[model samples]
Every structure is written in structure tokens, then in C-alpha cells.
Target: MALLGYARVSTSHQKLTAQISELKSSGVREDRIFTDMMSGATDEREGLQRLLARAEQEDIILCTKMDRLGRNTSDMIKIVDTCYKKGIAIRFLENGLSTEGTMGKMVIQILAAVAEAERERILERTNEGRVVAMAAGVKFGRKPHQGSGMALELIHLDTPIKLVMEKTGISRATYFRLKNHQRRS
Candidate 1:
């Protein structure tokens, strides 16, 4: 039976160094570990899909935490139940939880519910804070691209699109969009 590992980060910019290191230190090889640079809430994770497909009877799936596998109870239970049915086991290193016995399965279900509640609370708090900030005149979305204006100015001077992109670091798509905006004005 293989000791496979799965690691995930909520966003692409977040590093998986710590998770990978922990998995390696737990005796899982680097090559045996699967990683996804996406949110735990998303089901479109290629790495997780591949890992789940590869796991077989008696194999063990290792993760740092339950939330790393999924954010909500339903999703977490689904994964655990899938492994359980396949005669596979899952060991979560964070709290020393494993799906090797009836007690372990019960604990996982309880913890899954708690973790899901915690995630909901976090989202609620974040949205409330954002609302307050917006009330105080703070912007919520990304600011306009910094180089967009300069690129547009150069383009207005009849500069080549490629030259403008090279000088201002703006993409061709953005140049066209901004150029179209300029024309409409």
C-alpha cells in the first residue's frame, strides 16, 4: 500500500513549502505528494482528482489537516467515506486523526462539522469587515492597473502596440481595451 500525500493552498500565490516539508518529514516522498494551488472549496483540483483516482484498497492518504482536503463537512465526509469504502485510510497529521477505526470516523465527522462552522464564521466576519470598510469609503476591488495610463498615452502618440507593451509592461489585450475605451470617449 502506498502512503500518498495531498497538499493544497487557497491561492496560487501561496507557497506549499510548509505542507510539502511536513509531508516529506512524515516519510512521504516528494514524488508521491500531490499538490493543488487552488481553494479547498473548489472541486476542480486536478491534483486531488488524480490522487483520489490513484488511491486503492489498503493505501493511506495523508494530509496536514482535514480542512486541507475540504472546507465543509459534506465534502470532507465524502472524501473520508470514499476512502473508507475503498478499504483505504486517511491520516491527518495536525490532530493525529486517522480513519482506521469506528472512533476515528466519529471524531472526523465531529471535527468536520466544527471546521465547517469555523470557515463560515470566518467568511461572515470578512464580509462584515469589508462592508464597514466600504462604508468608510475604502475601495473593495483591485485598483486600476498602474501602467495602463502610460501605455494608453503612448498608444495615443501613434506608438506601435508592441513597443507600448514593451515599454509599459501592459498586455496587448489591455492595450486594445483601453484604446477602445479612449475612442468611445
Candidate 2:
């Protein structure tokens, strides 16, 4: 039975060095390590998809943390259930836990719930900060282009759309959107 390792980071800016090192220390080969630089909330990760497809009976899937498997409690439970059914075991290094027996399963369930609660709390805090910023008159989206008015003026003067875009550094989509807005006005 092969020991497989999976590492995940929320974005491209984050590194998987620590997790990879831990997995390597645990005797998982570099080639057997799968990684996803995407949100744990989504299961559509390419690396995860490949790992799940390649896993077989008696194969052990190792992760640095339980959250690396998934953040959603229901999804985590489903994954654990599927692994149990397939005779594949999951091991979380941080918690020193494995899906091996009744007690392990119980601990996994509790951890999954805690992980999900933590995720929700994080979301709530982020939303609260955004609301506070908005109340303080802070705009959250992209600032209007400094040359937007110039682009509109050029359009009104019958200048070519491509030239207007080049002069204003505006994309074709944005130019068209402005044109449509003008027409509506």
C-alpha cells in the first residue's frame, strides 16, 4: 500500500514548502505528493481530483492538517466515509489522528465540526470588517479610470473604439459597457 500525501494552499501567493517537508519526513515520496493552490472550500481542485482517482484500497492519504482535506464539515464527513468504505485511511499529522477505528472516526467527526465552525467564524469576521469599512465611506471596488471621461469624449467625437481604448488604457469590454451606458442615458 502506497502512502500518498496531499498539500493545499488557499492561493498562489502561499507556499507548500512546510507541508511538503512534513510529508517527506513522514516517508512520503516527492512524486507521491499532490498539491492544490486553491480554496479548501471547493473540491474541484485538479490535484485533489487526481489524488482521489489514484487512491486504492489500503492506500494511506497523509495531510499536514485536517483542514487541508476540507473546510466544510459535511464535505469532510463525506470524504472520511468514502475513505473508510474504500479501505483507504487518512492521517492528519498535526493532530496525530487517523481514520483507523471507532475512536478515530469519532475524533474526525469532532474535528470536522470544529474546522467548519472556525471557517464560518472567519467569514463572519471578514464580512463585519467589510461592513465597517463601507459604513466609513470606503469604496470596495476598482477605482474609476482617470481617462474614462477622455475615452467617452473620444467616442462622442466619432474616434475609433480601438484608438479610444489605447488612449484611455481601457479594455474593449469596458469601452463597450461605457458605450452602452451612454446609449441608455
Candidate 3:
């Protein structure tokens, strides 16, 4: 029955001090606090994964906010659901709620729903922006093949493929493709 603290900051510029202080003030042990200074969009965070895996039945998993748990609502719900199934409790200390009772349960559901809606809205807006950009003749991703001559020159330089890639920052596939395209033309 440990009171585990989970703290996160989305980027290097942000500080985890406030979150850590809050958790500590709530009686969370220093050793029990796990943190990740990475985007919540990724599940590959080592500290976060370890905290999730180490949490056990009747343990309290505390976070500064819902967003710290995940980038969106579905992911938050998935993490909460997993904890519930394990008899582990989730406490969003800032929100003053826990998955330990009815009101907390309701709040969790509402938050999750809102997060999911927000994710959908973001995707919709991004797609609309892309459409607008396309209609305006703006490019969205990598630039079109304008450096075929340079690619061919680099390929003929007697450099190893790895060396060429290191120098050009282009993958071997792209290098070969561009060289072939230039030869064909």
C-alpha cells in the first residue's frame, strides 16, 4: 500500500519541481516518485513505464494532472482502467479526485470523454489546415526531388553508403532512387 508519485514534464524546457513538490507535500516518499521529461504522446518513456509496471493492488498512483498521464482521453482511460483492474487507485492530486469512489469515477469518465473529444477536434483541424495549404499550392512535407545532380555526384564520390548517408542526411533508399532516376533521364 504505497503512495506512489508520478511526475512528468512535456519537454526539456519545463521543470518537474512543482509537481514533485506537490506530491511530496501530499506525503509521497522521495524514493517513490517517478518522473519522465518527455511527451505524454509516447508510451516508450522508461520512467513512466517502470512506475506503471511497479504499481500494485491498493497502491496509490498520484499525478499532477490528467494530461500528465496521457496526451489524450482514451489513453488516460486505458491507464486508469488498467489500475482499476489491478485494484490500484489513481489520484489526480491537483483535481482532488481519485478512482476510489463514485464521484471520482464519474469525474474520471468525464475527463476521459473530454480528452477524446479534444483529440478528435485536433485531428479534424489539422486535416482542414492541410487541405487549405494544398489548395494554396503550399508543400506539406519533404521537398520534391530538386537535387538529383548533387545526389549523383555524391554517389560517384567513392564514399561508403554509410558515409554518404552521414554526410547528406538522406537514407540509402532515397540516395539510390535519386541516382537511378537521374541515370534514367
For model 2, how big is the CA root-mean-square deviation?
3.3
User: Using Cα atoms with residue i matched to residue i, what is each candidate's TM-score against the true structure?
Assistant: 0.73, 0.74, 0.63
lDDT of each: 0.89, 0.91, 0.83
CA shift of 185, model 3, Å = 20
Q: Which segments of candidate 1 are over 4 A away from where they belong?
A: 139-185
In angstroms, the error of model 1 at 148 is 13
Give the per-residue lDDT digits (tens) of candidate 2, residues 25-87: 999999999999998886778998899888999999999998898978887888888888898
For model 1 the local lDDT of residue 180 reads: 93
Model 1 Cα lDDT, one tens digit per residue, 1-185 = 99999999999889999999999999998889999988888656899999999999999999998888988788888888888989889999998999988889889989999988988899999999999999999986767778988987997898998899998888888899889998998
* Model 3: residue 166 alpha-carbon error in angstroms: 28
RMSD of each: 4.7, 3.3, 5.8
Candidate number with greatest TM-score: 2
Best by lDDT: 2
Candidate 1 weakest lDDT stretch, 10 residues: 140-149
